[model samples]
Target: MKRSRAVSLGILGAAAFGLAACQTEEQTDAAAFSDEQSCVAAAAQSGWFTREDCAATFAEAKAVHEETAPRYESQALCEEEHGAGACGGDPAAASGGGGGSIFMPLLAGYLIGQALGGGRAMAQPVVPKAGGGFATPTGGTQLSRLNSTGKMGTTAFAKGPTTAGQPPMSRAAVASRGGFGGSAATRSVGS
Candidate 1:
């Protein structure tokens, strides 16, 4: 009887651990701003973020945008995904020895989130979507507008795969990238 009870308790503990692992991701306070000045302005009033935090996070977001924003083989394809006037020539590709002209969406905004453990803040770059919204580089999170504040999953700050130094994506490749709603599919550049 004693051994049976111990085994039952062990099973229950394991079940509890498994359930905990399936819990939803933790949420954090986050906000979106169209630019650094706007974030700084909000920081002065909200007290959740500081001016320094705004600047640093915005810079980080810009770098992430340049590194991770999806690249297209043509302006038409990029515009199709990002909307007209929202796409631009890839700066890295234009600098020389980049193979050919590449296009990508412009950085539409930035998201700043309170770190889960309360250290420094976190940031993610947002780009314009075809239907008039904003999304992270991975298209895992979408927001309707900038200058908004709310609770967001910590995963919103996660960086997407780097597109820098990679071959530009063709229309079919972009169609199949499948990153929306966090259901990203990994595929080789040439495949």
Candidate 2:
């Protein structure tokens, strides 16, 4: 009887651990907009956000884009990762001490998510992908289109490592670094 009870307790503990492992990430209401104007327009319809929220989040996203977007050694390499016409010379490199050879993707859009505990909305900037769609700087969250709303994991708003002042990545280095490769599971909520 004692042995049976001990085995049963062990099984229950294992089952609990399995259930915990299966738990999904926390989700929040999220929306993507191609520009600040679009976000402001949508703010009227989305009770979760306001005009002020749109302005604030858009600004925050742009700053995040400038700081965290991947930097490559050439426009061609940047374009190869981001779609053609989406690549641009790195603004920091041009203005700062970094080499002029650096390039980065243009900001395609921004994602705004309602804070889980009801604080200010969270924002993440997105850049164009090689084929189609947009992805966060870390390429951890992907969106099929802008002007769409859905539930997204809270992790989508997490900031990526800053690349602003770092040395531009060579093609081989970019491949090895892995954030811009879209390796994370694509999590698209709506169209």
Candidate 3:
């Protein structure tokens, strides 16, 4: 009698451990479903649910979709939950959506580059004033036109050069000319 009782207890403990392990696998599988159709299909594929159980589960998910907010772990998760372009107009619980300080670094780099003499001073596109004279520049030119003969800042190309009669190349084009370590000289070396 004592041996039988110990054997029964051991079986029960093993059963409990097996059930716990199964529940963990089920939870991981649950996390893989981003929406109702996929979830229902996965449940059906697993062969653990009856046809009636799959229908009931899908109905419950549909009802929940009408009532509660979606908790998305990331923009990607939200997009997967709904569909592509679904998260464009802000969804609940999306992470990493806030604006950052984009202008600070741009302004700092502009000022630093200007000080270092590596910066090219650009002629602002002419904007006509109300009366016909040139509009007063909001901020004056970077450095006073370097000399009277129209030598602006650098000894390099005074005014940005044009390409194939197209408009003059932009500052960015000038900055990122060739592959690594690109400069005006590097661009000329290629062509």
Higher-ranked by lDDT: 2 or 3: 2
lDDT tens digits, residue span 108-153, model 1:
9899989977699999999888877787876656777788787775
**Mind sharing the TM-score for model 3?**
0.21
Q: Which regions in candidate 1 have their CA more than 4 angstroms from the true location?
A: 1-21, 178-191
lDDT of 3 by residue, 30-125 (tens): 111223344345444553333444344445433332222222224443333233444332222123354321000001001000112332211211
TM-score of each: 0.82, 0.82, 0.21
Stretches > 4 Å off in candidate 3: 1-45, 70-84, 87-191
How does residue 15 of candidate 1 score in lDDT?
A: 10
Looking at candidate 3, the ten consecutive residues that score lowest on lDDT are 103-112
The order by descending TM-score is: 2, 1, 3
| Candidate 1 lDDT for residue 175 | 63
Residue-pair clashes per candidate, as listed? 0, 0, 0
Which residue pairs in candidate 2 collide? none
